[model samples]
Target: MPRPLWAGAISFGLVTIPVKIVSATEDHDVHFHRVHLADMGRVRTRKVCELDGEVVPQDESGKGYEIAKDQTVPVTDEELEKMPLPTAKAIEIAAFVDADTIDAVRISDSHYLAADGQVAAKPYTLLRKALERSSKVAVAKFAWHGRERLGLLRIREGAIVLHSMKWPDEVRDPQGLAPKVVEVGEEEIEQGLQLADRMTIENLSGFRAEYREVLEDIIAAKADGKPLPSPDEGGERKSGEVVDLMAALNASVKAAKESRGEDHGEEATVHEMRPAKRTGGRTAPAKKKTASSKTAAAKKTTARSTLAAKKRAGTKTAAKKRSAS
Candidate 1:
């Protein structure tokens, strides 16, 4: 087990469980240190005062909120600490509700929670057992880093688990992103649902950590001084704009079945809007990749016909290529 980064006592109604919060997740994102442009040397940043041009002392600095362009509101650590303290420090138990009631978007990250020592073993096991037997999550609140966070504590695989949650207002309504969720035809939605059901993979073997793999490849390629991959229409090395939504979806379904080995035959989506004719009048097949290729083999794919989609495609291409080897 990794060393615990934080040690604290979980507090609730009357029970205090001594526990340690360990670094639960490890991020493998490829990162590069900042470097001087001309010399290509590492660039280190420090907290230097603009007026004195010297590193500032931690005790001399404080956090401030900007009220206006030049106005500010100052808060002291002592005053901030007096506001409120969450009763339960260790995994607190509140009321448990049906898991289906909570939307998945509300969850952020999950962490494994374990008792500190042999002393907490019995109670921890009992709590986990109760939660598992009832098949309900404890909707509890925890004060983390001065902010009170809504979290759900549950039992998974005989162990306690926690999922941090977002506030109700944090999630945006879907109505603003499109015309109207109600305006969508029932048949079209059903078709989409069916398509999704068919496309969902039941086996883990079918899934790939392509993003991680691609990033690693690119890093190796760059270290070896290999040429960067080109940005072609993401496929067939040809570029064209999509004109219709429903048509594109239909075309994709057909193309997938024809070339991508799509199984489970999906139901076709029916949309009111149709795609416009290809403006550039180009027909190009994506470049084929060989085993000796230094760049990513699969092309970036997107169905969104907006600028965001284009930017995302570019990002995916770059990241994929960088990690690809």
Candidate 2:
């Protein structure tokens, strides 16, 4: 097993359990290093003092808080270590609340809480079982690294997991960017819901990041001294003003059904009233056909007119020849 990142005791009322925290997730993103174009040498950075033109060693450097425009107050590591915090070596449960009450956006990072030793295993199991039975999460506070953090403790997959939470102020206010209230018809709302239902999936395991895969392939090709692949030009999409909302929703539902190998016998009837089209300033009126569709209809009409003219000329020629005979 991998070594735990932190060792601490979890306390609640009169119960205490010695537990170790381990990271519950990992990053699989591809990383690159900066190199010189001429010699391919790895580029390195150094910390230098801004006030004095001198290279600062890692050991000599310490954290500081800027108090003024150009002045900062230096804080020593020893002083930070001596600061009083209840969670430095222990996680104290402050409250127990329904798990669903916590907003998913507030949850930040996750870690697994495991029993530190065999002596603590019983209490750890009891706490996990109790949390599972109550269907609630324990809100706890702890200090990790240099800052104190608020977290939630809950049972997951037969193990206790701790999730760090962001403060209420940390979440940005979305009101400024949110869309204004707009009227929507019942049929449009129903069709929109149907479209969403068609696209819903029970498991997200099948979804993979194709962009990352392509990036990795490009890197591999470069390493092997092979020719680079061209980037893909994705299909174009129509603007909201030109797009028939009901038609598009119906098409999406049909496509999704076809992708799942389900037989969609007949297309759903699109109601006349469409969902509001969002332009910059106001909702634009919906059109019967898009520009491309209008162009196609004009071409078809011209073709039919030309065909009718040719048929009339052929009949007139035949009549003239018969009269001459």
Candidate 3:
């Protein structure tokens, strides 16, 4: 079983529920060690004191705050633990707020608050059920690592979860980060919405770290003295420049639908609306002949043939008179 990181009580008005905090998430990243390139020797970093230039051990080191370039205030764990903060030994529930009102940007690390013992079971379950039924999260204040931090407590899978949050002042305003004002067509916006809908999923549980899987394969091949795996072909490379906005959105929606095994029987939400090409004063193609028009063309040909036959007969008559003379 994973060990508890901290043990504290939730001070909910008149009720106190003892709980233990454990990490709600774990990292599965592939770690690497520094090594010398010439002989592949492992290289390690050592902590050395600046003043004496001697290596320092982990247990001998302590936390210090630098007030100035050369002035630092050393603080010990005992002093921090014994500080007279109200939340030093308990998570003080300040108020309850609707869960939707909590800004995702302010939230950070999370921990699971488990009932510490049988004595804490009833109150812990009560708080969990209250949060679940009320559909609200508890805004709380707690001290960890020698400083007070804002927290949000809510129920997760029948257990209480404490999410560390930044204070309102700690979150920076995003006034300058946005782009300049520009107009977007309604069709483009609608197509973007369609794309979002096509890409939506119920949960993120289906995803995995494909990069780490490939990395592990590479390491295993190297360790076994075998040939390294070749890169997969036909991978789509993302491009920065978009020549046509509507065309890109249409393509994205189609691709997303195809990825999810959805049928594109109906046309996409928007088509690429392109301007009509200029003719440059060129004449257009003649229209196809209708039945009445074909009859009129045949009559004109017959009249021309009759006129040629009459001219030939008149020439023959003139030739006969000349011969007689």
Candidate 4:
């Protein structure tokens, strides 16, 4: 069973509904060991005071904000309770807006909002189902813990999903990060897009936390008193044994065709391009399919050329040997 991160009451005008907020996400990133070089010992640091250079007790510590240099603005626990922000109990529904109104950069966290009391079930379910059916979301303001957060309330998976959002001023402009580029012609653009379409794949499933799995398996093997396989036991794989370029591309295109029920025989050259723009009643792109096809349709043209050269050399040598005989 999942645990609720927070338990509170949601308020919208006259309606007060008690709800528990549960986290909707988990992470499994690889964790690393902390080690030291000296005597091969692990290095660790203690949280200590900067000036006094001494470890502070957890109970005696208080929060502080540094507006300038190392000078911290000390805040007591009681003082923070009376601070200017609204009390962290109420969720104020400001408006109902389109679910698409919130952008990726604005989203901070996701949460599952579940009703607490049986009396509030009807209204809560009504709101949740209504949002789910209408394809709309509610914009709300919430003071959670000690911080103020702008949030969106939408129905996801038969339950209410309250997603925290960033204020408009907090979202940075994309123009600063992305630079302008020159546009290509429609024909060339289409070819580039088609080539890019060739490289797409399905959702990530084959990929796994390799190190984590290896560690876990090794641990299990040790616990069961079984001999562990050497990590590098499978020696280096030969280049010839791995999937060849042509075979891999063929398999990928075949799999894609099977899934999408598409049989893309060959890539469209410049002449075969759509929109059919022609000059002098003749296609310039059509003339180019290809002017160099006999020599260029190869996975490794250079390697083939080298092999052909070697074969010619052998033939010439055999001919010379026969003449001498």
- Provide C-alpha RMSD values for all models, in order: 11.6, 22.7, 32.1, 21.0
Expressed as tens digits, the lDDT of each residue in 160-223 for candidate 4 is: 8889999999988787576578665775555545444643444466476666555545554565
Question: Candidate 3: deviation at residue 174, Å?
Answer: 0.6
Indicate whether candidate 1 or candidate 4 has the larger lDDT. 4
TM-score between model 3 and native: 0.78
Q: Pick the candidate with the highest TM-score.
A: 3
Tens-digit lDDT track for model 1 on 155-225?
76776677889989998887657544446667666656644543444356756666655555555556558
lDDT of 2: 0.78
Q: Between which residue pairs do clashes occur in model 2?
A: none
Candidate 1 error regions (>4 Å): 9-16, 50-53, 65-84, 181-191, 203-206, 227-250, 255-325
**Deviating ranges (above 4 Å) for candidate 4:** 37-42, 67-71, 82-87, 191-325
- Per-residue lDDT tens digits of candidate 3, residues 50-142? 999999999999999999999999999999989999899899999999999999999999999989999999999889989999999999999
TM-score of each: 0.66, 0.77, 0.78, 0.62
Q: Please state the error at residue 239 of candidate 1 in Å.
A: 10
Residue 241 in candidate 3, Cα distance off native in Å: 1.9
lDDT (tens digit, per residue) of candidate 2 on 94-213: 999998999999999999998999989898988898899999999999888888889999998999999999988899877869678888889789877766655665467879766655
Residue-level error in angstroms, candidate 4, position 164: 1.3
